[model samples]
Every structure is written in C-alpha cells, then in structure tokens.
Target chain A: MPILEAKNLTYTYSIGSPFEKTAVDHIDLSIAEGEFVGVIGHTGSGKSTLMQMMNGLLQPTSGQILLDGCDIWDKKTDRRNIRFQVGLVFQYPEYQLFEETVYQDIAFGPKNMKLSEAEIDRRVRETAEAVGLTEEQLKKAPYALSGGQKRRAAIAGVMAMEPRVLILDEPTAGLDPKGRTKILTQLQAFHKRTGCTILLVSHSMEDVARYASKLLVLSQAKVVCYDTPTGVFAQSQSLESMGLALPQITRIFKQLAEKGISFEDEVYTVKYGAELLKTRLEGRNPEC
Target chain B: MLKDITLGQYFPMNSVVHRMDARYKIVITLIYLVMLFWGQQIWSLAAGLIFTATAVFCSKIPPKMIIKSIKPIVPILIFTGLINLLMLDGGDVYWKWWVIRITEEGVQTSVFMIVRICLLIAGTSLLTYTTSPIVLTDAIESLLSPMKKLKMPVHELAMMMTIALRFIPTLIEETSKIMAAQKARGADLESGSIVQRAQALVPILIPLFVSAFRRAEELALAMECRCYHGGEGRTRLRKLQSGLRDYIALAITLLMFAGVIVLNAVLH
Candidate 1:
C-alpha cells in the first residue's frame, strides 16, 4: 500500500473572487513507502499547492488525502501528528530559521512534539550530523552561517522530527553547484539511512533524473504524467509543450539518434551518457 | 485563508468611474462623506442614498465586493445602532424596561445613524474599487503638494504610503509561507491555549520580520541604484488631467451636496 495517497484532490485559491484559480485540480496519485518521487512543473503549475496538501498544511477543496490508509482530514485524526509524520521543507527554507543557535533551531520540531529533552537533544544532534553540520557550526546562530550551511541547518530542523515521509520543495534552489551537490548528496544519504519516502519538487530535470525513482509532472493545475523517470522522460515532447524541458543529456542523446547515430534515447544523466558512449566506442574500436 | 482580506484592494474594470481623474474621485468622495454626515433629515438621507447608489451603479464593481468591504465593520455598525436605539431619551416611549428604553426618537436616531454609516462605507468603497492604490497615492500627493511649501514632506509621506500599500500583498504572501513552514514542522497553532498559540507565533513572526526587513533593505538599495532621490521635481509617467467627464462628475457631486444641505435646513 502507498504511504500517502491523494484521491481526486482539488484546491482552489481565492474562490468566488475575480482572481479565483484552481491551483490543483483533481490530482490523484499514490506514493508508496520508501519511494523518492520528484514533482516537476512550470512556475504557477500548482506543484507547491499539491505538496502542501499531501501533509495537511493546506486542506483540499474537494477530495481526501489518505496517509497510512486513513483519511488525514477525518474528524478523529490528530492533524498535528500528521505534520510530524510527513515533514515538508519549503524552498529557501533557510529563511525560516529563527532560533538563536542552529542547535536550538534544529530541536524546534522535536520540542514541538513535546518530546523529552534528552530525546530532543539526540534527534537534533543526529539530524545536524546527517545534514553535515559540524558541532561548532551548530552552536552559532543560523544567520551567522554561510548560505549553504544555513540551508542545511534549516533542513535539519525538519529532519529532526524524523518524519516518515519527507517532502522538500526545491531543496537545492539558489545554491552554487558544489552547495547543490552537497545538499542533495546529504539528503540522499539521509533518506537511505532512514528508509524514508521523499518527494523532491525540483525544476532541474537533470537532478530529478539522477535522484528520483519516480517523476510526477504537473501542468496547468493537472497531472500530465506520473511514472518512472525513464517512462516520464520518454514523453519529452509533451513536457516541452508545457514549457518544461528534458534533461540535457537525454536531449543530446535524442539529437544523436535523430542524426542517424544509433544510441539509446533513454540516457538522462551525464554519467549514464558517458557510459553508453564508452561502450559504443569500445564496440567500434575493438583494438583499444 | 489569509487571501480573503480585500481591504484597500482595487477591482479593475473599464467604466466612467474608473476612467475619471483620481483627484476628482477623491474630491467627490470627500464631498459625499461630508453630505452623509451633514444631512439630518429624511430627504437629505434619501438624497445621499440616491447619490451613493448611482455611484455604485456607474462604477461597474460587483455588489459583492462592496459588501465585502463593509463586512469587517459590521460589528461597529451594530454597536452604534444599539447605542442609539437604547440611549436617547426625549420622545414617546414605545417599550420600557429596567435600564433599557426604546423611544420614538431613539428608533428614529438609530435608523438614521445606521443608514448614514452604511452610505458612508458604500461611497468610500466605491472610490477604492474604481481607483488603484498607486493612482490614489498620486492623487493624494498632487492634492497635498501645496503643503510642501510649509515643509510638510508631502512627497515622502506619499512615497511611504505607496510603498506600504505595495508591500501589503507581498507581506501577506510571506506571512502565509512562513506559517506553512512552521506548521509543517509540527508547530500547532490552532488547538493550543492562548499563551501557547501566542508562543507558536514566535516561529512564524521572527522569520516574517527578518524577511520583511531584508526586502525593505533590498528595495531601498534598488531605488538608490535607479537614482531615486525623493520627489524633488520628479516627473510622473501618467499625468493626472481632469477631462469633461471629471467636471461633470464633480458638478453632480457638488449639486448633490448642495441639495442635501438645503433639504436639511428646510426640513429641520
């Protein structure tokens, strides 16, 4: 069974006003346990709205969100507990940091859960380490840290809750290449270590291709595609029509195929493209 | 959920009211407000009502939007009505109770106050619905330019108002984002006690304040980069010029106010 399921979920903004807009329209999808699902869309395509509904931050206008086979909006359910079970780290979450020390900031979530001090300490330290923040850096204020460090610290604030389903919206946005790689690598490691389901909302097709097991494409408040990375990227033409592009490596391989060069069109990442090219070259030059 | 606030919000539509000079609209609205308060008799109130209804009809703004602008002040309206209904003492008693009296004069005064207040709100809301905030600020600055000779800092005041008006939507959006972020971190803001709820706001408020300051600083720097040094001889992109329609609207407004004053004097 899926860990989280959104059934015919619809959310409208400013309903009954001139600016009324259907941000997410009847989006039906299920996220299984331990799956890294990447949500991609053009700006204003309702990716953020959909993510907010998954964890009960924003209520759906006309549908249900089921977590662990139970409706999250049910009257008997404790909505606050759902937030702990499903953590969401928003885009540029570093701006949400407010505690005097990064260590205290990370503990904010666990403390909100009313956990014991010792347990909060353990979770905070563990999450800080998981996000690659050193003990020295954890003692300083979040604003005192570098941009990448602040981002990691802010992410740790959510991770300390040890949520079963972690959702990150543009986790690596506004980061340098090295910072992006470091944050994504740490997130991947954290997911692996905890075996938690992650929904990564990203604009980079390459990042989604390299990390996400499944891809969900949103266009104009509707789900255009939701499938495995290879399966979704196969519909590159449709994605492009929606103002989204395929990964650069996949586009290069597609161009190569169009030029009569026989190569796999499914190559999405540079590493995979290099491997494919290396194999093809070895096949052509058998002497070397 | 925070998006429901429509205070000072403009509704864009092409109509005579929208096309009129902002200065004229401001002046006419002020005249209408003065008439609403100055008018004491039923004929004056009827005239005020007719003028407001005509303005609303011409603005082309939906009635629902105008009603929404009044929704927030319904409490004040009700309180004023109740006070007037119970407090006034010099007429034939209709109903009497311990510490409470409803007299003919009280009933008449209450009805008059309520109607005047409603007309006041409807007239002012029509002005906002027809005029955008930027244009309204421009009108205010132009009208107050004469005060600049007295060192009133008219340009600075208008600039501040314009910036504040511009940032209301931005700050609201930021506030909602911060609230969502904190809520996602298991911060319970709804079910907590009064103190707990107030405490929960810390996480959201600190972040909101930080971002607001950051945005203000960035805006200041951007303005400086563009060579903005206040409104000293600064020219405008869209000049405010009164046309024939504006004159006609002003004439109608003046005539309504004069008629109301005349009726009030004769009837009273």
Candidate 2:
C-alpha cells in the first residue's frame, strides 16, 4: 500500500480575490512505502504545493490526501499529527532554526510530539549525528554553526520526528557544490539507514539521478511523467520542451549513443558515466 | 494570509486622479480628512461622502479593491460605532438602561460618526490607491524640500518611508514562509490556549526577524555598492509638476467643503 497518497487534489490560493490561482490542479499520485521518489518541476509546477498538501500544512481545495490509507484532511484526523508523520524540510532550512542550541533545535519536533524526555534526547542526538553534527557542534548556538551545519541542524530537527515519509523541498538549494554534495550524500546515507520514504523535491537532474528510485515530473501544475530515471530521462525532447534543461552529462551520453556507441543504460551522473565507459572500454557489450 | 494588508498597497491604473501630481493628491486627501473631522453637524457627511465617491470614480480603481481596503478596518469601525452609540448623551431619551441609554441625539451622532469615519478612510485610501508609493514619497520629498533650508533631513525621511513601504510585501512574504516552515515541523499554532499560541509564535518570529535583518544588511550593502550617498546630488528621473488637473481637483474639493459649510448654516 502507498504510504502517502494524493487523490485528485487541487489547491486554489486566494480564492474569491483578485490574486486567485490554482497552484496544484487535480494532481493524483501515490507514493509507496520506503521508496525514494524524486519530484522534479520548474518553478510554479506545483511541487511545493503538492508536498505541503501531503503533510496537511495546506488543505487542498478539493480531493483528499491519505496517510496510511487514512484521509489526512478528515476532521477526525489531527492535522498536526499528520505534519509529524510526514516531515517537510523547506528550502533554506537554516533560517527556520530558532532554538538556543542545535540540540534544542533538533529536539523541537520530537518535543512537540510529546515524547518522553529520554526519547526526545535520543532522537535529537541520533538525527544530529546522522546529519553529521558533532556533540560539540550541537551544544553551540544554531547561529554559531557554519552555513551547512545550520542547514543540517534544521533538517535534523524534522528528521527527529522520525516521520514515515520525509519530503524535502530543495534542501540543498543555495549551497556551494561541496556543501550540496555533502548534504545529498548524508541524506542518501540517512535514507539507507532509516529506510524511510523520501520525497526529494528538486529541479536539478543530477541531485536525484543517482539516488532516487522513482522520478515524478510536473509541468504547468500537472504531472507529465512518473517513472524510473531511465524512463523519465528518455523523453529528452518533452522534458526540454517543459523548460527543464537537460544536464550536460545527459547530452554527452546522447551524443555518444548517436555515434552508435550506445550504452546499456542511461548515464546521469559523471561517476555513473565513468563506470559505464570503463566497462565499455574493457569490451563488455558497448552497444545495447 | 498576511497579504490581506492593503494599506500603502497602490492600485495601478491610468486615470486623471492617478496622473495628477501626487503632492496634490496628498494635500487633497488631508483637506478631505479635515473637512470630515471639522464638520459639527450631520449635514456635512453627505457632502464628504459625495466628494469621496467622486474621487473613487475618477481614480477608476475597481470597487472590489476599495471594498478590500475597508475590510481590514471594519472591526475598528464597529467598535467606534458601538462606543458612540452608547456613550453620547443628548436629545430625547428613546430607551433607558441602568448604565447604558439610547437617546435620539446619540443615534444621530453615531450615524454621523460611522458615515464620517467610512468617508474619511475611503478618501485617504483613495490617495494611496491612485498614487504609487514611489511617486508618493517623491512628492513628499519635493514638498518638504524647503525644509532642507531649516536643516531638516527631508530626503532621508522620504527615503526611509519608501524603504518601509517597499518592504511591507517582502516582509509579509518572508513571515508567511517562516510560518509555513515552522508549521511543517509540527509547530502547533492552532487549537491551543492563548499562551500556548503565543509560545508557538517564537519559532516563526525569530526566523522572520533574523531574515529581516539579513535583508536589511544586504540592501544596505547593495545601496552602498551603487554609490547611494544620502541624496545630496540625487537627481530624479521624474519631477513632481502640478498641472491644471490638480488645480481643478483642489477647486472642486474646496467648493464641496464650502457647500457643506453653507448647508450646515442653512440647517441650523
């Protein structure tokens, strides 16, 4: 069964006003349990709106969101509980940190869950370590930490909730290349260890290519494609038509294939492309 | 939700009112306010209402936008109306209670007050609706230029007002973003006691304030980088020039105020 499901969901902002807009228009999708789903969309593609709906932070104008097959929008269901169950880490997460110390900040979500003090402490420390925050670092004020550390601390705050599904909206946005890679790799390792359903919302093809098991693409407030990375990347023309720039690595692979040196699989990341080239040079079925 | 604030939010439209010198608009709005408050009798309210309605019509802003401007002040309007209705003491007594009594004169005074207040708000908001904040600040700076002789920091004041006005929407957006982010982390802001709700706000307010200061610093750096030196040699692309339309508008408003005064005397 899908852990999080949105059915015919539509959200119209500023209704009955001059600024009325339909952010998410009749989006229907279900995310299965323990699946790392990559949600790709340009700005205004309704990906943010969709993620907010899954956690019930934003009530859909029409339709329902089911968490564990239970309607999250149902009056009987506690929306706050739904938020705890489906954690969302927004872009520039560092700005959301407010507690005196990193430890307190990370403990915020678990504390709000009304957990035992010991459990809150355990989750905070564990998630802090998972995000690579040292004990000394966690003791320091959140503002005292470096940019990447603050971002991780804020992400750890949400992860401490131990949500069944974690939705991060451009978590690595605005970071340097090294910081971005560090965060992504840490997230990848965290996902591996926790086995939680992760919805990584990003526009960067490289960010999700290596880790995300399934790719969900949206354009103009509607879903264009939802499939494996190979399947989604195959529609190069359609994706480009939607204004998503095909990463340079994808182009290189395409050029190679056009020259009749086709590989068995799509090469997304430079590392994966290198691995594929090595095997091909060693004479193991270069042409698919 | 914070976008509901319509104060200082300009409605962009091309009309005589919008095209008129913003300084004149500011002066006219002040004159209209004075007319509303100066009137001692109920007869003057009709004149003020008519003037405001005419201004609204000339501005060509949609009635919906005007109504939205009134929505935020409805609470204050109701509170003031209720206070006037009960507290005022005069004329023939219609109903009597222990501490609160309704009198014929009190009812008249309350109706007069409510109408006057609405027209007052409508008139002033019409100025903001027709004039963009940038133009409005430039007009103020031009009007206050003479004060520079007296060592008044007119440029600085106008620049400050412009910055404040410009950031209203930006700060509101930042606030909503912070609020949403905190809420997603299971920050319970709803269905709580007053104290609990206030406590919940800490998460949002801290981030909002931090980002606001950060933005201010960034803006300051950006301004300095572009050689922003306190308006000494500042040259504006658009200069405020009073045209025939402004004179005509002022004359019409002055005539309406005179008519109201004459009507007040005739009624008495």
User: lDDT of candidate 2 vs native?
Assistant: 0.88
lDDT of 1 by residue, A177-283 (tens): 99999989898999899999999999999899999999999999999988999999888788899999999988888889889876745898899899889888877
Candidate 2 chain B weakest ten by summed lDDT: B1-10
lDDT by residue for model 1 over B48-74, one digit each (tens)? 888887888888888888787789789
Which of the numbered candidates is closest to the native, going by highest lDDT? 1
Candidate 1 collision pairs: none
* TM-score of each model, in listed order: 0.89, 0.88
Task: Tell me the lDDT of model 2 at B102.
Answer: 95
Residues A1-288, model 2: lDDT tens digits: 989888898999999988999989898898889999999988999999988888888889998999999999787998888889899999888998999988999988998899999999899889988889998998999999999889889899999999989999999888899988888898889899999999999878988887799999999889898899889998999999999866678889999999999988888888889888887788756575
Instruction: Give candidate 2's error at residue A285 in angstroms.
Output: 16
Task: Give per-model CA RMSD.
Answer: 3.3, 4.0
Clashes in each model (backbone N, CA, C under 3 Å)? 0, 0
Candidate 1's C-alpha lDDT? 0.91
